[model samples]
Target: MGSDNTDRNKPGIANFAALKTAIVNGEDQLVRELLSHEPMLDIEKSYLIDLAQLNKNHTIIKLLENISVKK
Candidate 1:
């Protein structure tokens, strides 16, 4: 039996949680990597922005803003 694993490989809560951690920790590269692979919803983006703001992460905030604007 053959089955595609693409769906299984899709980012889920763990990725989201990791994104949150990356944002809070000011890990730009990790954040970029996660964002590149995961399609975040508007609510998720907003929440990430809020988290970035809380941490005063201008870099992450700008990154999120740029991506949000592009999409």
Candidate 2:
């Protein structure tokens, strides 16, 4: 039988709202922790990058970029 990797990769957050909040508020550590916990789709990563760009958070933007690349 095949193992269920999909569930294992699920994000810890209940929803995107929390992540959006963290990104909008410039919470780099929280963002890092959240992102490290799981994987996100390319579109989701793009949206997060946009939000980080809007807030001018280069650190978070870079983090997102790195994660996106790794994924």
Candidate of highest lDDT: 1
* lDDT score for candidate 1 against the true structure: 0.80
Q: Model 2, range 15-70, lDDT digits (tens) per residue?
A: 56777899999999988777764567888889889999999999999988886432
Model 1 lDDT tens row, 8-48: 64557678889899998899999888876435578777889
Highest TM-score scorer: 1
Report, for every candidate in turn, its global Cα lDDT versus the true structure.
Answer: 0.80, 0.79
- Once fitted onto the true fold, the runs of candidate 2 whose alpha carbons sit more than 4 angstroms away are 1-15, 69-71
